[model samples]
Target: MATLKVLGAGPVKRGITQIAAEFAKASGHQVNVEFTGAPTVRERVFAGEVVDVAVVPAATMDEFAAAGCIAPATRAKLGHARMGLAMRKGAVAPDLSSTEAFRRAVEKADAVVANLANSGNYVAKLVGDLGFAADKVQRQPDAVKVMEQVASSPQQLLGAGQLPEIRELIDKGVAVELAGPLPDALQSVTAYDAAVAAASANAAAAAEFTAWLATPAARTAMAATGID
Candidate 1:
């Protein structure tokens, strides 16, 4: 019964947490995961923070493979997380049926809240391209905080984050509700990957856990959390 230490990206926290429990039950291995922003995950791994596994955006996993921090052969694509919008629970759902409607909704909202992560950066640029004032987008440290800010706001602020993050907050009844995904043209999908650390003490168990991420049951669990 070896314990595996994992560093995972925040956007996939809900799905990964669920799957880690399932994996632990089936394999009798204890999986401990620390979740944070994708950039921080890369930074820590590059700084030689030792862990049995690392789960992050696919591109960052590529970087880790190149840096020899993760075993190339153990890397597996997890799933794609799409950008989505959320509002305070009971707030009127905004019209996101088309690009123009999305723009109008953004224009009318008191503010657009987003985290300082990959999905938030994309949304910031998106609103900028739409001619919305940059000041209208409020940036927070992470998705959880973004949802919290929107949920607590008395104004009609829209929260932007990875779909899974938003869905998790809503499922937890965090006083926020999904307003659907971003418009097709304005959508951004981030693919995630998981890999065993090359220097892991429990390499075999870590490899087994990473491999399980691609299983059909795991995929279904991820999809239920909006990680499809």
Candidate 2:
């Protein structure tokens, strides 16, 4: 009953699409959820790509709305997300139950991959939150590159994963056991939101889908996909 063109950043993209598919099945409509990092999503939107709704990071969403890409008033603050650290499955998962342990893990780690835009901000915030601001390790801006590097490297660190994505990434050659888990304070959530594009062709449908995202059914789907 609906068709939504949405944009999302990494970290929770796999979960995002899984939930979107479920929503589509329930809504009796086709939902096309595009997955990309915050930077690429911004690039696409800013470059004038056509889309109906978006579920990017809260900060990026606000900027897009302010820039007239998304309807300012149509914006709704979604919930938060957790950025994690993943290693090779056979290796040791980092001890990140605390700030100190997280720092140790990152310091002792080999390679670190993170999104340069939204995920990067969250990971950076997490770094600062974990008192590792001085570490000065830069996470990559692209998710594919991050995934590739981690898979090839025996010891790699990933900075995203809300659950099923983590599981999927692990299956896709992510260094699960070799890398580690997300940090403690780094466990901060990124508030996701929905908004209609000002130039959308189906504003009503977009609004309906956005509203659906906040429903219990949607939340149930999101939770099932590892979104908070």
Candidate 3:
């Protein structure tokens, strides 16, 4: 059986994992998928890991293509991830209908928690732009840890991460409630893509798997996982 190594970010992780399982069963290939922060994904690529396919932010795909790590022509966008907020369970969910309201909410919160990658970076800048001290933000290395901090905190902390991840945490009873997406004006969306590695000996198999990721069945799985 052909084995494909895949690396990617958190937003599409659940969907991608499910897709990989189905792909393996149908195509008779083994897929080893790893999901991490976007920056780490880039680091893995730059370090020359034997990755057959990479599913990361679209912008990262450009970087990988420029570095000749992946075939530019094979890039296929999977989906977009929107930034969102999560508040402790039993806490009042704030109105985030506008950028002004979001700013105000952040100002009133006792503390704000966010992962230092992806959506968290955007939240950091938004906090700074809103006149909050950048250093005041609790920056964690990963979304799961960020939510863990928020869930265990007694203070009113607002945690931020990619919407899909936050939703997953809520489903898993992380003591957080979905406070909705960031206001449209300050909203950040990341489009994820999958591309075959340029150095892959399994290019044909990798290409087929990546192509299958864009099919209707895959989309259905993505939607079910809150990726879309």
Q: Name the best candidate (by lDDT).
A: 1
lDDT of each: 0.89, 0.66, 0.88
Cα TM-score of candidate 1: 0.95
Rank list by lDDT: 1, 3, 2
Question: On residues 1-228, what C-alpha lDDT tens digit does candidate 3 reach at each position?
Answer: 689999888789989999999999999999999998988999988998878999988888899999999987778778888888999888899989998899888988987898867678788888998899976588998989999998899988999888889988888889888887889898898888999999888998999889999899998899887777
How many pairs of residues in model 2 come into backbone collision? 19
lDDT of 2 by residue, 129-212 (tens): 555643544566565555556656655554444444565666666555324456565465677777888888888877777776
What are the TM-scores, per candidate, against the unseen true structure? 0.95, 0.79, 0.96
Better of 2 and 3 by lDDT: 3
Query: What does the lDDT come to for candidate 3?
Result: 0.88
Per-residue lDDT of 221 in model 1: 88
In model 3, pairs of residues that clash are none
Candidate 3 shows a clash count of 0
